[model samples]
Target: MIDIRDFHVRYGNNHVVRGIDLAVAKGECVGIVGESGCGKSTLLRCLVGLEHGWQGHVAIDGKPVGQRRTHEELARVQMVFQDPFGSLHPRHRIGRALSEPARCMGLPHGRDRIATALEEVGLPAAFADRFPHELSGGQRQRVAIARALIVEPPVVLLDEPTSALDVSVQAEILNLLSDRRDERELTYVLVSHDLSVVAHMCDRVLVMQEGCFVDQLTPEDIGAGRASHPYARHLIAASFPDAA
Candidate 1:
């Protein structure tokens, strides 16, 4: 459902994402694993039209993403950002954040839709009336997920979806995401620095370094410690010290 070819992004003179070519089929969960500054998130932002300096072809659901995307086009792919607290305004209630996407897309914005989104993320419908500050870190992230789902997008790009939460909370969020993907038949391109998280959630994992993917690992390869590239091996070792 998503395709990119020869994609490159630069900030001034510094090249961030260089020559990224990838394709994600419908209902597939693909993971991009790399350390910070390796350009995983930069590549992701480019796909969603957050970065304008990118050069290449990006098509989501057969629609080429340009410098500016209309509300309807953007609703085709939703992004769940790294920071949930910053993503949501301090003053706005959870309901407002969830409904804002529907409002922008001219879709029906009502309590039932918002409440269903909240419940889908394991949050009660009543939490919609509460503010972001009133919730814990996990609760805040759940709200972020709800907001992403409120648009009913086919593809969701997750940037470190569980980085800020505690371990138990992270497991909960990952399980919730897996369940939602099955229930909604959603496609996901998950970006994270954790190989274990990628292994647990993704069907295929792309190992990125220096703004390019050095190797790709499937579940079988990861399980057998068969990463071919040096950087990929190092990442797998770091994620599993005892196994290393």
Candidate 2:
């Protein structure tokens, strides 16, 4: 549902994402894996229209995305950012936050839709009335997911959605995301630094380096053999500290 070709993003004079070409099919989950400062988050921000001033092409489905589109058109693509605390409004109730997208789109607002969305994200219906500060980190993240999913966008960009939580909480969130994607038949482009998390969630993986894609592999590649790219191998080694 998304295609990027020869994409390059620059902040001031420095290019953060360099000549990236990627395609994500409908209902598919793709993971972009890299170390810190590898431009994964920058690329995702560009897709979501947060970062402009890039060169080359970024197409969602078939329409190009940038600052040129209407707000409603851009709302078709939603993002779940890494930090729930920072992404959500402390003053806004969960229900208001979850309903804002639909309201912005001029769609009919209903309590049933809000309840369903919260339930789909593994939160109780009553939690919708609570403020962001009242929820735990994981719960807040789940509310963030609900906010993103309530729109029922064709593509959801997940930028380190579970990176801040504990391992058990991370696993629960991952499983919830996986189940929701399957149940909703949603397309996801997930950015993560954790190789194990990527391996568990993604069907295919792209390994990024510096500012470009260095390797693309299936889960089988990680299971059966070593990654061919030096940086990919290095990342794998670091993921298992005993091997290093």
Candidate 3:
């Protein structure tokens, strides 16, 4: 559903994402794993139009991104950012936040859609009336997920969706995301630094380093001890210290 070819993103003279070529098929969950400063987040931002001033071809469902499309055109590709607290509005109630996206998209706006989104994210209906600060970290993240899913976009770019939560809460959110993907048949490009998380959530994994894709591995590579790239081995070793 998404294709990026020879994508290069730079800030002044410092290039962050260099020559990234990747494709994500419909209903496929592709994980991009790398350490901090590897440009994983930058690539996600560029794909969703948050970062401009880059050179590359990013196409979603055969339509090219950037000046070729309007804001509404880009809405088809939504993003779920890492930080739930910063992503949501402090003053607006959860209901309003969830409804605003649909309203912006000119879709139907009512309790039914909002309720369904909340339930789909494993959130209680009553929480909709509360503000973001009033909810726990997990609830806030769920609200963020609900907000993204409300648009019913075919592809969602998740930027470290579980990084901010505790392990148990992260598991819940991961399961929730997995269930949503299966039920809705949504395609995802998940950016994470955790190899184990990617192992559990993604069908295929892309290892990135210094702003480029260094290796691509299937779950079987991880299972059969076949990831042999230097950086891939480093990541695997760091992920399983006892085994190393």
Best by lDDT: 1
Q: How accurate locally, in lDDT, is each candidate?
A: 0.89, 0.86, 0.87
Clashing pairs in 1: none
Scored by lDDT, model 1 comes in at: 0.89
Model 1 residue 234 lDDT?
87
lDDT of 2 by residue, 1-244 (tens): 8988998887788878889899999999999999789899888887887776788977887887765667765777889999989999989999999888888877655788889889988899998799999999999999999988887788899999999887879999999999989988889999998888888899899999989999987776766546879887787777755543
In candidate 3, where is summed lDDT lowest over 10 consecutive residues?
Answer: 66-75
Residue 132 in model 1: lDDT: 96
What lDDT does candidate 2 reach at residue 237? 75
Model 3: residues with Cα > 4 Å off, grouped in runs: 242-244
Model 1 lDDT tens row, 109-224: 89998888888898899998999999998999999988888888999999999998889889999999999999999999999988888889999999999999899999777767
Q: For model 3, state the Cα shift of residue 213 in Å.
A: 0.3
Where in model 1 is the C-alpha error above 4 Å?
none
lDDT of 3: 0.87
Sorted on lDDT, best first, the list reads 1, 3, 2
